[model samples]
Target: MGDWYSAEYPSSSLHSLQGYRVFISIAMILGDGLYNFVKVLGRTIFGLYNQIRDKNSRSVLPVGGRTSSPTDSLSYDDQRRTQLFLKDQIPIWVATVGYITIAIISTATLPHVFPPLKWYYIVVIYIFAPILAFCNAYGCGLTDFSLASTYGTLAIFDFKTGYMTLASPRSMFVSQIIGTTMGCVISPCVFWLFYKAFHDLGVPGSQYSAPYALVFRNMAILGVEGLSSLPKNCLTLCYVFFVGAVVINGIRDIVGKKWARFIPLPMAMAIPFYIGAYFTIDMCIGSLILFIWEKIDKAKADAFGPAVASGLICGDGIWTLPSSILALAGVNPPICLKFLSRKTNARVDAFLAS
Candidate 1:
C-alpha cells in the first residue's frame, strides 16, 4: 500500500504508461490469486478432515445423556433460516457488474486521483478482480495476512525491470497508486487483519509507528538524486557503521544466548542514530524494567506482563485523539507537574502588578 502511494506522488513519466498498467494489473492478479487459491484449498481440505475426524470420534463414544446428531446440533428453524439467507444473498454477477460500474465511474470522474484508464487495464481488472477477492478472503480467513502492500511493491519493481522504457519515476508512481488502490478494494483481508492485529491488541491506529516510511522516502530521494547528493565523508561513515553493526551482531549470535545478553543489540545501538534520544531512553527504561521483572518471577512476568505493557501503550494512545482535538482548538492540556511548569515568580509578580 505504501509502495503504491509512493509511486503515484510527484509523478514523472520515465516509463511507458500502457506497459506499466498491464504489468501492475497482471502482477496484482497473479500474486493475490496464488495466495488465495492456496489458502482456500488448505482450509477446505482441513475443514472436511476435521469434520470427518469429529464424526468418527463421536460415533465411537459410548451412548451418553447427550448424543451428537444432525437433529441435536441445529433445529429445523435454524437450518431453514440459514438456507433462506443463502438463497436471498446477492447474485455474483450482479455484484460484479456493480463493482465494474463503480470502477468505470471512478476512472472517468477521478482521473487526477487514479491513473489514466486504458481498455486493457479495465479488462484485466474486471477479469482478475474476482480471483483477487477470493484469494484475499481465503488468505485472511486462514492467517489474517493482507498482501496489498507486498504485491504492490512487487508490481512496482517488476515494472521497473520488465517495462524499462515506461519505468520513469512518474509512470512508476501512477502504477503503484493504481495497483495499491485496486488491491485494497479487492482484498477484505486488509481491513479485517488491521482490526484483528491492532484493535484487538488494544493499540490505536494513530499511535502505530511507521519507521519504514521514513526509510523509503530517503531511498526514493537518493535514487532520484544519486549518491553524490550526499556528502562523501558522511556516506563513507554510513558504510563503516553499517558494516561494524553487522559484524557485532554476527558475533553476538555466534556467542550463544548467555553471552548474547551482555552484548548490546545492533538495532539498539543504531536506533539512537535515526530516532530521538528521548524516545530511545524511554524504550531502554521500559526494556530494563521488563528484564528485571522477568528475572525475578519468570512465570508471573510471562503471564501478566503483556497485559500491563498493553495497558501502558493503550493509555498513551487513547488520550492522543482528544488531546489532538484540543490542541487544534487552541486549548492546551494543563501541565500538572510543578517541575515542568513554565510559570515563574517573575511572571506571577508581573501579573499581580498588571
Candidate 2:
C-alpha cells in the first residue's frame, strides 16, 4: 500500500487525492461559467432586437418635406445602421469568440488554474450590456419599453447592492444567483427527502396540492390553525397589489419622469409573481398529467419518462430566458414577451402536450 503512494497523486498518506474528484470540480467550474455566459448572452440579444425594431420603424417615416440637416441625417443613419448590425449579427459573433476564448484558456490552464476574468466579464456585461439594451429600446421607439434606465438599475444593483433590494433594479441576476446557489445547496437534501417520501407514498404531480392539504390538515388536528380558514380573497388582494405597483411605476416612469424610483420596486415585486405564476401553473398542470398517466399505465409511464423530462428544456428555451432577464432589469414581462415571442406559444403548447 505504501508503494501506491506516488508523486502523481496530490494526496500523500491518508488524504488520498482522487482524480475523479479533481475532474468533477473542473467540470463544475466550466459548467457554471458557461451557464453565466448563457444568462448574459440571452438577455443581451433580446435587448438588441428591441433596439433594431425601434430604429426600423423610425426609418420608415417619410423623410418628410422638411429639409433635413446634414448632421441630423448622418446621425440617424449611423444610429440606425449600428442598431441593425448589433442585433442582426454582432452579439453572436462576440459570444462565439468569448466562449472559444474561455474553452481554450481553461484547457490550457488545467487543474492549477486561475479564472481571473470572471469579474472582468461581469463588469463588461454590467457596463455595455445595458447600454446596448437601451439603444435597442430607444431605436425600437416603444414608449413603454424602458430598457436603458432599467438596465442601469440592474447594473447598479448587481455591482453595488448585489441585488438584495426588493424594489430597486429587480436584479434578476441577483435573484438567479440566489436561486441557483440555493438550488445547488438545497437540491441534494431536498431530492433525498423527496425521493424517500415519493417512493413510500407514490405521490404524483396531480397530488401536489396534497402536500399543502396535508400540512393544513395536521395543523387543524392540533387546533393550531389561524388564517387558513379565512374566506378573504387573497388572490384579489394580490391582484390589487399588482395593479398598484404597475400603475405607480408607470406614473413614475412617464409622468414623474423618475425611471429609477418607479422602475425598481414595482418591477421587483411584479415580475417574479407574474412569470413565476406562469411557470408554476405549467409545472402543476404537467405534473397532474404525469400522475394521471402513471395511474393509467406504468409501462407507458416508463416509456414516456424521457418525454416528460424533456419538458424542462422548454422551460429554459429562448423564450423564458429573455423574459426573466428583462424582468430582472426592471423591464416589464409583458412588453418583452410581446416584443420577442421566441419559441411561440404554439411550441410551448406542444411541449406540454408531449
Candidate achieving the largest TM-score: 1
Candidate 2 per-residue lDDT, tens place, 92-127, comes to 566568756765565555434546445455545545
Cα TM-score per model: 0.36, 0.20
lDDT of 1 by residue, 71-132 (tens): 45765644554444444444678767888888777556654555554555666776776666
lDDT of each: 0.50, 0.42
Q: Which ten residues in a row have the lowest lDDT in candidate 2?
A: 150-159
> Which pairs clash in the backbone of model 2?
51-136, 54-139, 54-140, 55-139, 167-264, 167-265
Question: Worst 10-residue stretch by lDDT in candidate 1?
Answer: 10-19
Error of 2 at 270 (Å): 4.8
How well does candidate 2 match the true structure in TM-score terms? 0.20
